[model samples]
Target: MTNLLLLIPVAIGLGLLGLFAFVWTLRSGQYDDLDGAAERILHEDDEY
Candidate 1:
């Protein structure tokens, strides 16, 4: 019973942390160029 008190908050905190990190990525344009990234890999750069 005592362990549940501690484990519950820890689990909730971890879940909230993950949610916030996901939201941050969305707002930071991390997913805005998903297709661009895939296509870019197929092209070659001219850099020496």
Candidate 2:
């Protein structure tokens, strides 16, 4: 019973941390060029 009291808040805190990280990624444009990234690998570049 005592373990649940401590573990529940810890779990919730971890979940919120994950949600914030995901939201941060969205705000940082991490998903903006999804298709571009997939197609970019197919094209060869002239960089030496």
Candidate 3:
């Protein structure tokens, strides 16, 4: 019972932390260029 009390809060805290980090990434435009890398790789750059 004592272990459950400690572990429950720790698990909740970790879940919340992960949710916040995911939200931050969404707001920071991290997914805005999902296809950019694929498109860029197909184009060759002459500048070495």
The clash numbers for all candidates, in the given order, read 0, 0, 0
Compared with the true structure, what per-residue lDDT tens digits does model 3 show for residues 1-48?
999999999999999999999999999999999999999999999999
How well does candidate 3 match the true structure in TM-score terms? 0.88
- Looking at candidate 3, the ten consecutive residues that score lowest on lDDT are 28-37
Per-residue lDDT tens digits for candidate 1, residues 1-48, read 999999999999999999999999999999998799899999999998
Indicate the TM-score of model 2. Answer: 0.91
> How does candidate 3 score on lDDT?
0.99
What's the residue-level lDDT of 39 in candidate 3? 96
lDDT of 2 by residue, 1-48 (tens): 999999999999999999999999999999998899889999999997
Q: Which residue segments of model 1 deviate by more than 4 Å?
A: none
As for lDDT, the candidate ahead, 2 or 3, is 3
Q: How much does candidate 1 score in TM-score? A: 0.91
